[model samples]
Target: MYAATRIKNRQRVCRTLVAALLMSAGAGAASAQDQPTISMAINQSPWLDSFVAMVDQYEEETGNRVELDVTPFGGLLEKIRNSVRASQGSYDIVNVNSLWLSEIYSGGFLAPLGEIEANYQLPEGVLSYGNTTNWDASAATFSSDGALMGVPVNGNVQVLYYNTEIYEQFGLKPPKTWDDLFANAKAIQEGGEYYGFVPRAARDSIVYNFTPYLFSHDAAFFRITGPDQAEVTLNSPEGLKALETYVKIATEAGPPGPGNIAQGELIQLMATGKGAQAIAVIAAWGQLEDPNASRVVGKINAALLPAGPDGMIASSAGHWVAGIPKNVAPEKQKAALAFLDWFAQKERQVDYVRAGGVPVRGDITGADLGDEAAFRFIEAYSQNARHAVMGLPFASAAEASDAMALSFNRAVIGELTQVQALNQAAADLAGVLERAGFTVSKLPDL
Candidate 1:
């Protein structure tokens, strides 16, 4: 009975989504000569080729043209900001990072998907695979006040990648906790063939690499105390401990010039066997199996990140989503939504995964991928995404992240002690919130 009920429910969702799609098509149907060209801004990454292929398929099937402007992940947000400020319909569809969604939505630059289709509902599986609480609180990321805003294209989470040969050589088991990770890193470093671990520590990348440690140790930038009151909380003992652990790893066991490392470099370091382990985005794992890019193709293995003192595996969700800008013509808006609807279908999503993109739908993650190691890693990542948090969801998230990055990079370079760094970060964050019109109380001393 339970199985039957589930099947019926899934069929119902499919029917509803299909109905919405048909409605969208009918609403926008016009003379063939009146169709407008659509363009999209996408991030250049491992998945770019796959997305391009999908877009080609879209064009072939719909007789519509889409120009793709591929930009580096670091620059995409700034590009969107500039375009929105000018009210230029530079692109009909825009790729958005989860952390940047609140800013874009609050800026009034997005056309609420709800307004486009009032009865449209996300597939049950998509919601099941995301951080449900966050999806509710910051609905703008996926939907705003029950209106869909974007379709998630990539589901990202941090995982630990280790060199199996190195672990066995040193008699080390996969780390179950942060202490184990540190000890293993130190041992691997002392053993001399490779650095113990390599993690992204560049100014822009440090916050992402540090979040797991911070959350595992029960530290956060702010804690809501009342209906509208909050306090900075990153100067507590847990915060200091997490920062100290990060600094020790970077200075003692990481590669020379730790501050210069970013995700691409870190991946190469691991793939070239220069590093024994890396804690990075799971999406990069696909590259590790590429013969053209990796030397240690079969030598690498992945696992859920080590837990913290609280015995919880804390990961950050860095999923990428696609939204339509409000500046586009109404016809272009409809075309963009039509494209998004087709791209997010289950069959296309599966094709995307097979072609090197990360799948954000639960059914896709749970599907049998035939490769045991690949399936195991993706399964772990999917589980992590459900509980992960994208910290600092306010419009000032970028500013807050920058402040934390400065403090973290300072600690990495030995300019400040862990306590000093975190305290300074807390103060910086408080100032950011205050300027944004939120009342923040002073954090208690550790």
Candidate 2:
């Protein structure tokens, strides 16, 4: 009954919204075309609760109409793609994940913010993802010379999360390397108290979860050779070693059916006190301390992800970005610009974190939210963001990542040996890059 009433209320709200828009078109000195009425497309994510409330506040404060279209993470890409292709302005603003940045921007479907605001500059304290949002067509890579296409919506990067109580019980220190992690996780799992690890090995996101391991082991999916050129390098000795450790830890210390684990499941494992540790995005920190959402609140502590073979941490930058769609009409573009203009305000950065969204500006990352515990992970988050690597940033990033993800999932599921998966993935990635017009070659398979 409540669900039905809520749906009806939503319908009524939509009707009222449309009516208000019509009335404003005739009443305001600013033309209806110049009004900041827009539909923003975003994925339903862990941070949606805070973001929605913030959007409501924006509407209430400015009296501008905004239609937020939420979609599942998987379908968001296609929705943005189809909307851009239609060229009818179904959405004025679109969410762009770091992985999708190259693909969407390189295709010329999104307009640069500079084109909308000639005097534009990213707000102070905005965290940098050097050139990831800026695409250089001539070089076929993110470069300083590229068009500045998007702004950081949230700063998210993988961080090592662990149960401090579990570590205390085990008399263990934090894991700093792959071998250290493996040994510690094995010990915890054998203690029979809780899972020692829970990686996000789901096929849809395995590449993201696996990136730190690959980089730490000194392996890469593709090595940039020159402008518009790369070589598939995943089948190298380092990658083989990385995969071996990844599979070994997931199977020996992680919950069964490891290949099916994603962010939600990983969070549940830790939140319910069933798991001891995992490397997960810092955005998860928001819900970890809420009494209703977590039983182990305040028991969780974060650190840098385990260092690689080279003794360097290599967490992947997974920040979501916001940009305008080029296919939209000029009026819609201006409407989108107004929203971004509001977004660029520094005061809103603090409000964003308090409302559960991660802020991109480093200066305000540690802003007080009345609850000291709310941003306890800010130190680790900021450190990780500073060193985060851009994962598979290129026009064919999706295709390449998909191919790699499939092989990684199969390996985790025991459907294929790690080496077989790596070789298959490398070959598949090579083909993907070659077809995308990148001059691709292959490193000798291990």
Candidate 3:
């Protein structure tokens, strides 16, 4: 009879503990529902899918509802611009590409992140990984009125991706310079096994893909001389060399109809083993490793872009920053800032990498990721980022990129020589700067 009584007493204690836990969870849920719902606008890329999954966790913990507007990248900027101009509080938080930061900030579309930084006690340089400093002078592109405008969330740079199996079969090594790249590409294409190299040539994307080549040769469309002054340099000797190399790669060894290839198509060509090599954004690394999508999964290696005549390796920087729109309601802004705080925490950033998004925090990037191969690629990407230069940062950067793209396209299609294409491009870029109220300097003869 004493043993039975002890058993009953134990059962009674377990039931009481369960009831208390349930009560606590219910209370937490009640508190979560008290806050207003937040709406966010983000790209519809795979990276954003991972981010949305994380947002789901945040919502469950805080009891705040979040509505996501996942839009295609092409139309996202115009959508945000219109909403901000109309002061429509449709989105409490928005994602801003580094390229568009100047236009967005200059238009008073984003709230200054200064108060949020102080409230959270965020450390200096917390948002930057690799060689990018949080408040460097270059960061002025994303700031306005002497205040930070956004928190960086993604870091990207261009890298060369090559098929290791193909290289080994051909008894070859990766190229170290543009000349080496051309020679290897020619030899591989002549072998008739695979196309030598592939890259995006679409007019809208050609400039981005061509930047590493241009920078390697120390060429630029415009050189910033001061805060508001820039000089046209697209017709320089370096510019001609870079353009000639770019055209030769596509004309001599690239796949048929190279003028139509875009970033996505270039990645697909490499992933499926059709192309032996490619130069693309670091984000493509994940796609190359996806077993379901890639035939060459685990058979590819990434490296820094090849050097130019100057023996310098340069890449274009492209990252995304998150900000609260000025049109957001006051209370909603607090909620959005709270979410940013949670998202930027180092531990959370590490988790984000595991979920397929790149981490922009140095601590997280340098952490011990359990996957060895992934860590190696991240290391390479971070190293390449160290040598990256930002694309044009002015409000008219889009127009300037368009000018360069058109010139590159014409040259790639044999419509004009490299010198002719670059000269015309320089003239167009000068027009863009002149309209933006900056004096354009005369170009020397090539």
Candidate 4:
């Protein structure tokens, strides 16, 4: 409720500011066309406050009206689908999650940055994930030879989050390895005060949560065996080992009934002090510090995710990028580009972090924001993002992710053994890849 109220207040303030700017600029309806009103279709996120602040500043300074069509996370794709597929949709700018990049790319819904602006180039030192901005349309895959579809706006990573007080109580420092984390989690769980860890097992969360495990272990959904080959490896020995460990972590060390926790539920559990640790998204750090929303206000802290036995530290990179829809007017596209350019400035990115957004720029995240930067997540996120990788980057990424979610959920809930789950997932992935025009027959039957 507080968040809702805050957003409402911000909207009111933004409208007032925009009205004042229009008045000062003598912007009658006749002059309004001079300042384009580009609209964005975005998912409501933990960094909404930051996003609104950024937009507010953009509108006031440029005299351009920007309307945000915010939707719930689950509804984001549907909203984008409705807008892009229409003869003339309402959204000029479409927020692209890396996981959905291929879907949007394959459908030809978004205009490449180069297409929108002939001279477009990624800003120096700006991190782009999974070839998100680059797309080979003919092959429906991310490639350096492809067009620039968008610019990354958020650099969200999975970082290790723990209760400082709990660690201090148990003489534990933040874990640097999976073994260390497992031991600490077991100790905390046995103490009977809190669940050692909370997991995100909700259907939407499983694929991302599981991918880091696979990556850290040097296992993958499939390795590129040839120029266009996707060999099923999720049921390989290494993959099996990773899945087994993940299941043990979730079922043996996590809370009772750990199979259904979603992103919000996991955050709430940690905030309420019911959970001692987790590998959670950097964006979620905001709510954990909100006095009214969290009981563990200052108790929680973040660290880089633990390394696997081989010492590889992999983290999930599911960033959000902004792409201009091809369906929008040319003026709107230019306006959208203007906003993207404004947001990408280094100074503006720092301001965004202050307003509660996790910026994609490395320089800003690595900078010292000072001791005055209280109750914020910066260092840990900075460390984690350095090792982050796009969990699943494929033309059929959505379907592939859904398969992982289903199998992981089954394993978590004890409905399927870890081995069976991996077997099913590997077979499902092969079919998904083959149907999407990739070679998938290399693997021996799992």
Q: How high is the CA lDDT of each candidate model?
A: 0.73, 0.77, 0.72, 0.77
Q: For candidate 1, give the lDDT of residue 52.
A: 65
Among the numbered candidates, top TM-score falls to 4
**Tens digit per residue, CA lDDT, model 3, 296-334:** 988998887889998988888777877788887777876
lDDT of 4: 0.77
Best-to-worst ranking by TM-score = 4, 2, 3, 1
| Residue-wise C-alpha lDDT for candidate 2, range 1-446, written one tens digit per residue | 12222323454422121112122222111222337578888887877655665565456556676677878899999988898888486888898888888888878888877787685556666776645757777776777677777777778889999999999999999888989988889999999989988889999889989998988888777777888788888899988988998999999897999999988899988899998999999888766777899989989999878887788778888998888988888778877776665554556656666666777766654544444675778777777776677768787787788888998999999999999999999999988888888888898876
TM-scores of the models, in the order given: 0.82, 0.84, 0.83, 0.87
Off by over 4 Å in 4: 1-35, 87-89, 224-229, 365-368, 373-375
lDDT for model 3, please. 0.72
* Model 3 TM: 0.83
- Could you tell which candidate, 2 or 4, scores higher by TM-score? 4
Put down candidate 1 lDDT per residue, 236-346, tens digits, no spaces: 888888888888888899799898898889998998989999888888787888789999887888777878888877787787878888888888887777777767766
Worst 10 residues of 3 by lDDT: 14-23
